[model samples]
Target: MKKTLLGLALSCVAGAALANDHDDRWMLSTNLIFNALDNNKNLESDFGLGLGLGKFLNENWTLDFEIDHVNVSQEGGGGSVDQIGLGLMTRYHFSPDSSLRPFLGLGAGYLDHNGSNNAQAVDSSDFMLNLSAGLRKEVTDRVSFLTEVKYRLDTDDYTGTASSYDDYLFSMGMSIALGAAQAAPAAAPIVEPAPQLDSDGDGVSDQSDRCPNTPAGMAVDMYGCHQVDGDDDNDGVKNSMDRCPDSRPGAVVDADGCEVQVVIELQGVYFDLDKATLKPESISILDAAVKTMGEHGTLVVEVAGHTDSSASESYNQALSERRAKVVYNYLVEKGVSADRMTWKGYGELSPIATNDTAEGRAKNRRTELVIQD
Candidate 1:
């Protein structure tokens, strides 16, 4: 018994030596205890006082050694008995950072029975096993209120007979951690891993990121991939890549989030005086238009026809219609998608230049491919 007590006292002292600041590494506790004796023991339940020394094994585990003393009266005026216990308990505390920590405990102890003045009770001792549950509420960083209920299993018999007893113990008290709130180190601080860097400014860091060049403010998954996005305006370009996010429907776009523009023009294409036939020079420029259409399969254009003011509006309108239809038909024959092309006649009303001079009149007789979208 002396050696066991000595070892536990040394453990408590060692735990105190391992404290720093408000870490609460070691504890001193006192409890008001109530012992409920078994009915077969012929002694009434009574109150006791207990003292313990404790150590935090880690953040969530604690080791404790306690001594308790209680006086129990004999049932029929035989004399009171003194019950004392010396024990070591290991407790598991849940949710270590909370204001009120609940815990479960298991321990083993030696219970000593001492007969009082009349000597009706016999002095004996028994080994005991204990299971307990409790709560520890922090009153401050260094102090706490503790409440517990314990079940003690033992085979103790005060009278020399073939009987045994178990006990239910209730306790409530307070504990104080031993150390100054601010002090030197008893143990080294825990080391933490260095933080990983995200060079691309995406939420995911460079270490495991597959798409490290993702732009800022974009949503990404675990592997740093941009989330699947929609073409909100039905512009064929996804929102993530679209520079002009609000592009109109059917607007054709390039890979760089821009509208696919054209160097393809109908500038050199001019027609004869009163005919809808295509001039030989018109073929090259027109074929270039066909190639451009094939390159951007989504390109939609209007084949617009205009005429010089050489005739009445009614006659010029009919001539314009025939001119536009001729070019439109040629494009379809050259494999330009008909679904993406529309033909229209503006007549002399929408001429590009004045018809007052020869050069101006020639310029007014024009067929142009105007982008529709």
Candidate 2:
């Protein structure tokens, strides 16, 4: 037991070099445990104590190394049995930053029963896995109370016995979160604002005014002027310097009033089930993309197609390829130059959301237009 605990600590320390940036804190915990042994063990339920050394990887995740000890007395007090356990568990926390957090976990471990002192003197070692759920309630900045239950699937037979047994562990404990040992990101320096003073009283100050001799009763922009009226195109650049007078709404425009192509997620673009043909309702979104490309003559696009994991990997890959090709062909038919675009299929490899629910699956089936330099 000592050797195992030492190895676990050494392994965690050695892993620190590769994990400093993600180490949110260290979790030190202890639990009062009730172990319900399998009937095959011919043992009664017993109370135990547990110790844990864990690393919080982020707001939503933690990896814990655990050790527990329990002793059960024989029915007639003929003798007592001792059990020691060691495990490594990873947990996913929900509502991590909230005052109360809930988590679920899965882990595997080894258990040893010492029978050297018993009249039977038959020892056994076995492997086990557990499914766990728990809740943590905050008490302070560094401390929290924890309650959890685990169903352990034990494997292997007791010494000279053929039947296997499982165990249930009910635990309650407190956890202490250690401080981060790494440096944090640097903060921006604070700058005091200069005093506001205007000599002409036209709102444009003498220290910043490009034109101070503006005639009274006439409107002027920040850079006092008679010809430029704020911004006509409303594209951020002044009218006097705006080479293109009008620009599309929500478009990325350059300083000279030209559109600058950037990556875009085609939100409404979708296809029919098991088919690559574009849906009628999705045409408007594609048309908008085409219009943007036409407005920017030098703009290049990469049509990327993705899909949900409803089908086989090979089938999804081919389906995604067809979807990309269909979009590529549509743009070309609409006068987009063939040399200005490319197409690729990512299949189900890149998912933006979980696929375990219907809404998430719908979101996973998506398309994107990437701009190339």
Q: lDDT for every model?
A: 0.76, 0.76
The residue pairs that clash in candidate 2, if any, are: none
lDDT per residue (tens digit) for residues 152-225 in model 2? 76664654554456789999999987874324335579999888776666788877676678787678776665
Candidate 1 colliding pairs: none
Off by over 4 Å in 1: 1-24, 116-121, 161-163, 183-373
Q: Candidate 2: which stretches are off by over 4 Å?
A: 1-29, 39-44, 52-65, 88-103, 115-122, 136-146, 155-162, 173-208, 218-222, 226-291, 294-373
Taking all chains together, the TM-score of candidate 1 against the true structure is 0.43
| Candidates in order: C-alpha RMSD to true structure | 34.8, 11.4
Error of 2 at 315 (Å): 29
> Candidate 1's residue-wise lDDT over 1-373, tens digit each?
4346435644543554343211235799999998998877778898899999987754556778899999888888778888889988877788754768899977777889887535554778977767789998977657889999998865576665545566899999999988864332255578996689898887777886878889888888666778687877677656666678876667666653576644234787766536688889988988888898899888789898887766568877898899999999999999988899999998889766655444566677788887877
Model 1 lDDT on a 0 to 1 scale:
0.76
Native-referenced Cα lDDT, model 2: 0.76
